[model samples]
Target: MTMEFGPDDQIDYDGPVTPYRQLAEILRARIARGDWAPNRAIPSEARLVQEYGPARTTVRRAIKVLVEEGVLFVVPQRGTFVAERSSEDR
Candidate 1:
């Protein structure tokens, strides 16, 4: 199944892979493809759970990895978002 990481890196996951990594890959692909522009609001953990059918902790772990990698950022209440990092930052 093809997953589309939309403008905000939200995905329609349909793979047998581990959900958290799948989720991370979706975000990575979106950034690589420029589907998600820099500094855009990414889907929240709750939104991701709904989309990926994963546990909250799993989603949070995926997001945390992205944040650590400079692929995403978390703002209190505002939610996670795509970070505007240059290629060198990756």
Candidate 2:
């Protein structure tokens, strides 16, 4: 099932889920909705922090989770990009 998030969606700081995990899910939904194309870099951590009102560390943690899940991949000097899913990933 695909999950989608709208522009108005905001992270619930006091919600049961941790902020990092919530940010991760929001990003996952954004990716699934094609906010960023495959292999295209996502917004920088600073931009995300400004947009999501999360701390820099929180944004980094969310990105790390996506990377570990193969949803994203980071290029050291560049930035993070959406992973191009293989047929086996379906």
After superposition on all C-alphas, the RMSD of every candidate to the true structure, in Å, is 4.8, 3.0
* lDDT agreement of model 2 with the native: 0.89
Q: In angstroms, how far off is 22's CA in candidate 2?
A: 0.3
TM-score winner among the candidates?
2
TM-score result, candidate 1: 0.69
Give per-residue CA lDDT, model 2, range 8-72, as digits (tens): 57798887778888899989888877899899999999999999999999999999999999999
> 84 in model 2: Cα distance from truth in Å?
0.4
Where's the lowest-lDDT run of ten residues in candidate 1?
Answer: 4-13
Expressed as tens digits, the lDDT of each residue in 8-88 for candidate 1 is 554345556566766787767767777667778876778778876778998888888889988889888787878887877
The C-alpha lDDT values of all candidates are: 0.74, 0.89
Please identify model 1 stretches exceeding 4 Å from their true place. Answer: 1-18, 87-90
Q: Candidate 2 — which residues are off by over 4 angstroms?
A: 1-8, 88-90
